[model samples]
Target: MADRTSKKPPTTRKTSLYRLTDDGDPDLRSLIRPRYLDQEGFRARPVRQGPLRGLLVTGTTAPGPADWCQALADLTGLAVNEENHTAFGLLIVRTEKHIYALGHGMGHLMIEPARIDPGFGIHFAVRCLEKDRVTKVRRQIMDARGRSDENSVTSGEHIRGFGIEEFGEIVSHIAGKVRGIPLTYTGGDAAGAHITGNDRSVKLRLGRTPEDLMNDLLAIEEVCERDDPLPEFDFITQVRPLEAVSDLAQGLDARLDEMLGTGVPGRVGLAVPSECREGFDSAETFRVRVARRTRTVPELDAQTLLGPVSSCAPGERLETLRKGKVQMFADSDAEEVISGNVSAGRWLTAEVVEEGAHYFLWQGKWYEVGAEYLATVKRRVTELLARPSRITLPPWPKGEGEGPYNEKRVAARAGYVLLDKKNVHTARLHGGGWEVCDLLGPDGQLIHIKKAPSGTAPLNHLFAQARMCVETLKYDTGARRKFIAKLDEIAPGHPARDFREPTVVLGILLKEGEPVTADSLFSFAQISLLHTDNVLKGLGARLEVVSIGR
Candidate 1:
């Protein structure tokens, strides 16, 4: 009794796909969680023919109607009682090379975590696109000091662009810290392209039919096999090399264990991950706790939470403690509880080296720096060090004084005018008081000095101050005048009369035995300094970096 006139259902559907990078066929019976499979009317069967020949699964879960249905019915004075059921399906296509997962609704939750490839969608998107326009970009910039900023940008129309400059200047500058957790764009042919991040996976919208899905997978795999599509973004890469090299991966695990035993907050601290943005603004405060019985800590710092870990009882390992869940709870009626890996929350700044390869762990992920990229960064740093000191400043007194007094003493010894605490009011320029520089050289050199830091926060702050000063002086005539006026009052005969473009010297006072070299700085500090130097050069100012041993 089927009606021949009825048209066939649409062949296209929005599909969420994942590629299994591991070898061997996974046991399908054990794949889906038992709770989901135990639901009513769950069916799973094997397919032996056609393009979708693998495993097919379907399930249904009835959780009743949404809570808001009753509220909407009361307000509208109409009957709105309705039952709700979630219908999900999955098709696992096994090919000669690898396995592909096509999921619908909540099908992604069916598979266990071990079989999926991380960063697959991102790598695919970067490879297939041409040199044209990027409409959206999602990026996370972390300062290695536990603070990070995640931003998402979208365009209403396909815009013309290529590389990082496509996001414009300011965004490009901030993106200098890191690039492309996930990137979206419109290709040269003007097709809308996007790649979205999911829980431990990524999503791509593509044709759902078996044939089209197979073809797309092959094309994507071929493209990714080529060389890196974007090399200019090597400043902070997202790809994890440890995934492929088992030896290096093992070494990293051991390194993490040793560092956790030290329990030093400066070397490793904790924070709420930048990616977990749900209900963050509404939470008044966030407290972290490890074990069920351990009292919750007041803040997210490792010093406050872990203290000197040596004080722990025998047979207790911080590494084991790190595996415990970090509960971010707020004191409110909502009582929102968010949990993530304590190890992921820990901010690890030390570099890991194995077999001449370098890696950095920040906010839970490992970022590998290629040998060529490392060399280039070192060369830039060396060039900065080659610039002679503008003034013959003395070595800092061997751990004998604080920053402000030492700055004054150094300036006095070098015949430079100390501008410490000389806060200039340039509401029109920056909307608040900020120092132009710590020391104003008599010959027009702008000197900024800070003691080398155990953490990157102080160095990042120092860099930001120098950058703001350069930008404000370059653009604001009134602010420049105010600075000169303040300068005259501080040192009457100073030669910095008009405040034109001047040489900027960033001096770091190292500990007594630390030498002045490229390796003296942390990787993050070097990265920030390079970006600041580039910005300064673009504004027609020269930059010099020096390390003074105490």
Candidate 2:
């Protein structure tokens, strides 16, 4: 027995991070860990399902059937058994809208002559065991063996006795029953499978799908499911023309054989007749004609023509045959003649020569012609002429200063200046407002200056004077002592950083051929001069050293 007490009012609400299924079971965990969850305290929620579709089809053929069985297996993945002459397999047919399949298998049977009434040689029974819809069926037959069977062979006498009309009727009856059935021809009786004809060939027929077949068959289970139902048809029914069907079946069989071989059909080549050749005088033209059939001149027959000749130059003359003999003359000199003739369409020979205004006696008559006429005759004789010569130019000059005048120095001398301090003097020169000079220090180290100078100062001369001062002061004890005392009193900081009132910077140019010393105090004094130069150069100002005192 338990005692009950009044419940207290709820103070807060609770929220859940874990999710449960519709049946209240905890949701399952993921098989893989998520990258963001590597920190160890993360979880994933449930996802929803979407739509899906698929399909399948299965079929089988009779045992001992070669061509059709092999073709079906290759194209549709159906399996076949020789002993059964039957096949059983499936097709997984898929499309965007849905997934489905069809499964089927069948056995074959031979009909007795009595039952196959019209007496067709042999009759085969085919049945559709399962399908989504009625399928199209095609049939064909060939000699399973290369020759007729001895056991089933009929004598010509028996065939004649049966009568042509009777035999025709038997064939008709057999064809009618096989019309919609899927059939194949093989060597031997129903037991042994030998493909007939060349490589045991036969015609292939397309089968109608179950949907288009008899309505009863269309009610079979969906393509994706397995369902069985038997549909029967007579084996002696009349079929359409077999010759056309046979041709198609044979083609399909051939394609199958090709596919089985190298997985691709072999290619065949075609033949093309060679073209007629054309002739020309130049070997270049002849070679071209051989490779590419191009005739430069239509009238120049390959059998009779020769060269491409040219006429005389301007103001040239040649002899004119006005009446078959050298009759008239014309100005200038004549050039060469290019002419040729053909013989028997086989060989071509040509000649070239120069023609002038005057010629020796021919047939006892001296002939004279104007230069112009000779030139014209020369032009007519030569079928073509070489191009004119080109003009030559003089060579270029080799050494510097041998060409144009250079004003680079004029631009360099724009600014100049001179400075003096405590009887010490210096000078500077500017080009393009830039300093260019060689500087020296007290310790004998030469310093080179090459930069834009400040304002109007002669930067080069100023540098030279500063260098001379350093060197001159180095050997004079009294002067050095005084300079050192002045430097010690002056701060070595930049102008902007110097807090001392009346700070004066001395701008000096070290002279050429002077020396520089490694003494720290002396170096400092020289550095101060360099700093002063930099400040003046940056500000575009000019400066002069006034004095050096103790």
Best-fitting candidate, scored by TM-score: 1
> lDDT at 276 for candidate 2?
13
lDDT of each: 0.57, 0.22
The regions of model 1 sitting more than 4 angstroms off are: 1-14, 23-25, 29-35, 38-43, 60-87, 142-209, 227-254, 262-307, 310-347, 428-432, 475-479, 497-500
RMSD of each: 8.0, 46.5
User: Which ranges in model 2 have alpha carbons more than 4 Å from their true place?
Assistant: 1-86, 89-163, 167-173, 176-208, 215-550
Model 1 residue 144 lDDT?
Answer: 25
**Cα miss at 357, model 2 (Å)?**
99
Tens digit of per-residue lDDT, candidate 1, span 328-419? 55554325665443442353345667688877655555566666666776787778778876665566666455455446567666458777
Task: Output the lDDT of residue 516, model 2.
Answer: 20
